[model samples]
Target: MRVCPKSTSSPLDEFLHHYMNGHDATVFIRGSRTPAKGTPAWIGALLSDLMVPVPFPSHSFDDVIKDFSLTDVDFTLPNLFAEPGSPEADPKVSGTIHVVAALPKQLNFDINVTNIRASANVSYQSHKFGELHLKKWHAANSTKVHDDVTGESDLEIYSRIKSAPLTITDSDVFSEVIQEVLFGNGDIILDADATVDVKVTTALDLPGDSLGKSLEPQISELRIIESSSAAITLSAVVNITNPAPYSASIPYINIHLLKNGSVLGNTTLRNVNITRGRNLNIPVSAIWAPEDAGLDARKTGVDLISGYLSSYNTTITAKLHPKSIPACPIIGQSLSNISINATVPRLSAPRDGHSPDNGSKTGRGKGEFIRDATFHLFTSTATFTLVSPLQYDTITLRSVNATAFWNHTEPVGEINYDYSFDAPPGASTTPRLPVDWSVGSVGYNELLGAMGGKLKLDARANITVAIGAYEETLWYVGRGIGATVRL
Candidate 1:
């Protein structure tokens, strides 16, 4: 049809002759035309039209072949929930799908589809797993030529599916997938068969449209509220900075706390409203279970505590699992692949009605557990002001083995206290512990020379502390300790 001569009749004439006899015909015409010598030659065009004498049945066009496929499938479910009276309050998943179609030259034209509703069966490892149902969807743009060699066009459409109702058609197979994701390489392939219903419009002629922000979540304050043999309860004030202008009501969100790639415990947030720019002071409770993660978990937990007390920055990861959001398993399954890491804020200083110099200087800062220390030289004893890192629970000092030092490295005295004493919530003074003097050392001589006066010393201690039934012994170093030499 590209070389059809201007002198020839319209190509529709041949179709008209066949149409009156109720037949379809394919026609091809090529013309040879010579232009004026030494002048540029351009081909002329033809306006061909065909009119049907009678209406054709819908099935009559079924003989025409259509080949198309879908690719670039990306699905996501935001933490947003549906409103009432619209779709079910269950969480909804949304994404875009691209369709590619290869057409013959005769039928090449732009096509637009509207009023679409579709359903698909989701399968994992050859077993039916879930269903994705779309109530309505739309594509605002027309199909455009994607590949010239194959005469293929691409159409992109987006939709928020109503609900992804999951049914574990085969429990064993589903469990295997979950087990692999948790313990193995963390990947699995899924297949889907979709059926779509839409109204299509085509034209022989054609014509010619978060610049997005993310949730910047911050932990403002963290505290140890309670503890037991298996777990410690933590309450935190989370300041979630929602940079986007949209507002959402999160009825529930549950995620697992992980340490060293192990599930330590889980945290929950409920009935929270997110708005623009810094939502402040949202109370979140978490159960920290190092016991559940194993012995190494306890060691890691101790390391975290050690780092926090030393004014070091530490972080914990909140990972989403398949059962995180119990209301919607599909959303949970989709989100379980993501791990959101957050910094564990240091514990604030206890607000007791005492200064740092309550007899001896404590140099108490945020996360500092020990407030002050006093050494009695004549009696060979020492007492310390201990700050309990708990809201309502008392911390029991089960045992103490410590050494007092002078000039950073010279030992002066040592204490070995085996009896237990309770340090209630906030600031409390420890019982005077008996110290054994290292009489021959230079530090002891310095202490003897400074009798009736106070000298700054350092102490290193292995202290065993217990809360309820949980007990852990940790090593601590105290600097600039004040010791009063008594007669």
Candidate 2:
């Protein structure tokens, strides 16, 4: 309280009491001598042995509110499961804490009092809440999470209070204590605050086999079947263990044949079933026609027949969806789609007991083939006698050039002819001319036995004859024979 020296009374002077308590007042006393006028009118007071017993009223949740049917606060280390210690030994916790002030007094600490009087300062602290800011407030975030148990929002709040009236109550008869506290009329409520760190992690649901061991699905027993010049059929068996604890079913299995990573053909297998921890085998096949191969079926067949002597690469990829669970969900299909690829390097065929295939020899298979590569070629000459009655003259001197072919398509390489005589156009009675030609290795092979093991080379000969100025030209196609006889 401050002392005003110059005393005067006015309604305007009442404003000075605005800053003072109701117990405070403005008192005026006359001085023995006249006080000095025009003083620097500052207010000050001095007193000795003067003390006011201001009831310091401040309250908070007791260490543990037993009367309110509450529980002992607890704290534990986050994520460090199975720690050895007394979680409730500590009076205050770092996580959520429920504070209950005794019954019937601002349950969640809401206090209302008017015509308020303040004679002192007040302060309080909740060590359980500490100074850390609140992170999650059940009441503020979700209405469903807030109930009578969650007294307030638990939002962070720090208040420095001063000059609030003190309410005095009987501590006992036995309840006079709240009467001596500040704004003591309110309900007792529970306020929960959690401070510990919370964490959540997610990963694949496939834990492991029933034995709790890891597993990898497998495919085996691959085979090639019914392979021929016209088409190739591949058959393979697939097997997999149901790693999960539940029965599994595969609705479909799609197998693709890939050559150097390109698709050749694909086949699907359906309705593959499996029991938990057991093997499931599925037989699958793919029939490849002429169109399925990058090369013609004949060549593809050759490669297969030759046991892939030169070694070509092929890979088989299996795509499937396995349900590790029975139809009852929560246990669902295999966690993800499954795919496996196995490479069959240099696919080879068996070579034992080999014989010529009907198509291989006859060239009449469902596929096209080039001519066979086995034959002999030879060239010889034969003479023809000219016997026309009108022209009985024989020419013994003449020259011949020839070319020949066998089977209308194969060229009988060249011609080598032998003659008995050589006659000039005007000369004596001798007939016929000699020519040379041949049959190539290819022709010989096709006609070795095909053309009666013999070849006939033919050519056209043009000759001009002169009988003392009566000159005329004669042209004829000539023929020669070659035998592919054994020595």
Candidate 3:
């Protein structure tokens, strides 16, 4: 009761039977006459099917090919690219790739792939972004395990690829890809078309193509840690959402931050580990150099600060520059052309780090300085209550020359103070400044006649103030300050 002609038991069946038997097929099936469970029957069917030239069904063959599809890749770039504090050097890339594929037991062979050189063009949404060059790779399936129960072989491939240069052909597309990763759903789909040349021991041609998708990393919690006239230092955390089963380690990464097409500062991440799920609390530091961005660097810097203080949303772009990878200047220079932008995190904490006092007449905003004033007619002196914007810093008043007016245009008296005094954070009263009365002026006569009354006076002053090692001269005007007359 043969299902097929006796001639179907040809060389292919003999070859498969011999191959399986050599690998202890008897352990699974004692004899073809009484095949234990279904192994021998399945083997016979597989052999009979092979007589039709296409031994594997089209769908089954497609499934097997899909099993070899690359799920993800892990790379250990040269130390110079991944580590910080290492001597800047542009060394060649040397790393191993582990690709695991499951195949039917009969397909298992001692295959060695050598001298593989491939170049792939990467595109997203029909737009070509770059070319990925696989300079050379050697692959060997030395670590393979056969599953007796499933009749499948798990082939573990170890491949080493070198000098795999990724050349960006379109920077705009690169930026769009980054934006998609940052703002879109966690995944980015990229189609890769590759042409490869390799010599396999069995001379089998396996054309491999894959649409790679990667999850976007999340960054949050940016805050100003330190500040000065020179630069502002910031700290943040990054949670790299790695979808793969493997992990990667980075020793250091430096990138430039840009604002409105101008370099704002440099950001650095050191000793980061990327693993499955969210890799949280990865520390990041950035140096904000508004003064060095462009010819109007200071203005740009001030605008950024002002925007932040005013609770306006702004964006900062990250880019690679020559100094991004000091040891690999050429690579850095090439990558510098590509940039990605993200919204700068809003500062949740108060800029002054204090609750606003609604009851206070002054210090309402950053611009408010003078609070109130008082005048002593007998002593011909006045004192002013001033508010400082700094929460932890202090201002030193070095010199002040001011004129008081009863009316906006009529000068009543003048104050000239040369001695320096420190005004700490919050509220402080200035020392009694000696006033030179204008005896003949109508404003002075009005002030003299109001012996025990309070008069609203306007004061304009040119003052010199210093914070730490920085000093600047500012002009201030106080309007409607209540001055109390005495004696």
**After aligning candidate 1 to the native by TM-score, how far in Å is the CA of 173 from where it should be?**
21
TM-score of every candidate: 0.55, 0.21, 0.45
lDDT of each: 0.60, 0.30, 0.59
Per-residue accuracy of model 2 over 223-298 as CA lDDT, tens digit each: 4455453455656565544333333334433444443333445555556554556565666666544344545443
Q: Going through the candidates in order, what is the number of backbone clashes in each?
A: 0, 48, 0
Name the candidate, 1 or 3, with the larger TM-score value.
Answer: 1
Per-residue lDDT of 211-287 in model 1, one digit per residue for the tens? 02233566645667777778878787787665433344556777898766877788888777655567888888888
**Per-model root-mean-square deviation over C-alphas:** 11.4, 35.0, 12.0
lDDT comparing candidate 1 with the true structure: 0.60
Candidate 1 Cα misplacement greater than 4 A, ranges: 1-90, 93-228, 234-236, 240-249, 274-277, 327-338, 357-363, 445-457, 479-487
Residue range 16-76, candidate 3, lDDT tens digits: 4444333322212222444357566777565544432333322232232212212344332
**Which candidate order results from sorting by lDDT in descending order?**
1, 3, 2
* Model 2 lDDT-worst window of ten: 113-122
